[model samples]
Target: MWLLFLLVAAVAAVFSCARVCRAAVAAARTGRPARPPAPAPAPDPAGDDGHAPGLTLYEMAYLSGGPQRLADVVLVLMAQKRRLLLAHTGWATVVEPVAQDPVERATLSAIGPDGQRPIPAVREALVADEAVRAVADKLVADGLALPAAARPGIRSGIRQVWAAALLVVLTAAAAYWMAPPGTDTALLLGWFSLPLVLCLGTLAVARFELHPYRDWATDEGEQRLPGKADPPGSRLPSAPLAPLTSLISLALHGPSALTDPALRAALHSSGA
Candidate 1:
């Protein structure tokens, strides 16, 4: 029984650790120019649900900023339109008290019925909302995003691998305590070490190879983003695209993208 469990655990540890490393590697690669998109994968029925036609400002925001970027973009839109107020002190107040879309509604929801919340708090809260998840889903369906099973920029898997390593250690200790008096426990522990070694070794290698990766697009997505300024669904000339263009800037560059002083303060330094 103990032998069987050890064998299973060893295989489990190897696969789980491999996944984390692969995600890190994929993240590193995705930051570079996207290669030509491969043949379209099967469509996710729930994805690409007309969030706007192909790759709108919101989509680009998700591509560049992930979920948090979505929050920032909405805040930018709302603030620009004078529908919401963001203070340098990190607080948000609704000005219009109305939402224009599901994403905006989600932001308003995060701010609560009291109509105010910290910018960071709202940003964090919105990350887990259905609307944010939908943006990600659309990306995946469009071949721009890696699926959840294969999504990158995650630290949770690392923690899970560590937990698995701990389990192996504890199981080995328990096995040793239950073994017959004459049994050679060292050899048994050595067998268990196979999985532990794999887990720890992968983590150590990752420390050197990995950085904080926020990119979520495939090579094709990366390739198409360069020199791209038109927001999705709008065919207007760059002149007419000015407002959205600034949004694209905010989406791609971040709060610093704007020249506005107060917005820079609210999105940048978190103080009153």
Candidate 2:
């Protein structure tokens, strides 16, 4: 029984590791770029029934500086007078009088076609207007209202976690099926999985670390390690030998060797 369990775990570990390794290789080649978030869709002011022509939720948000924009979107529900108050058109519509400062409320009022007033009514009117609806629809179709960029690291991290989990479950199951129940195979499988898991984790970390400041089209992650900047000129030695040469130069002369006349002359004449 133990032997069977270990065998199953081993098999699971192998497959999981293989899948993650392939993904890591692919990610390396692409030089992970941050994914751009899709823009929020404008709401249909014509209402949910589609009977009226109006702005969609997204369009209304844009005009009111409300939703759609990450900065403007509030997760918390706004309330007043111990009752939930919803914003209509662009104004806060409350059943009870607001106890909050009058000055603050006045400042938040929306300006509409008629004049400056509460926002809820104006928001509703625009959303219900046929022109707003058409514009909102067009905006979504044109793809002009993109939200924001999402970090590639996050996606990579998620993938890594998923891969690791799958590998663990498979390894455990394989070990159980392959080995006798009362054997040492479970321990063996556990030990084997440690190294495999570590390798996958390391690769995930490496990919994320290298993603930023990396030009995927040209430079691979391995080539862009610390101090891998291009040489300033041909006269300059290769990167690895650079520090030693600098030390030698400094030892022979001093820090001023960097600014020496002879060095400058040589550099200028070298076409570097």
Residue 9 alpha-carbon offset, candidate 2, angstroms:
3.2
Clash numbers, per candidate: 3, 46
**Compared with the true structure, what per-residue lDDT tens digits does model 1 show for residues 1-272?**
56866876787788779778777776545444344423433333211222223455666667766787778888878888788998888889999877767888998999999998898889888889999898777667656765565553346667767877887787777777777788778898889998999989877776554422325555545444433344432332256545555566676666666657888788886521
lDDT for 104 (candidate 1): 86
TM-scores for candidates 1 onward, in order: 0.57, 0.27
Per residue, candidate 2 scores C-alpha lDDT tens digits across 1-272 of 44454454455555555655555454444433233323443442111212112323223233223122201111001121222233322333344333232222322232322334343343444334444344433433333222112224334444555665566566666655676556676476676567467545655664665343121111322231222232322233446654333322322222233333443332223221
Question: In order, what is each prediction's RMSD in angstroms?
Answer: 9.6, 22.4
User: The CA-based lDDT of model 2 is what?
Assistant: 0.36
User: What lDDT score is found at residue 102 in candidate 1?
Assistant: 86
At residue 210, candidate 1 shows an lDDT of 46
lDDT of each: 0.69, 0.36
User: Which candidate leads the pack in TM-score?
Assistant: 1
Stretches off by above 4 angstroms in model 1 are: 1-53, 152-214, 226-242
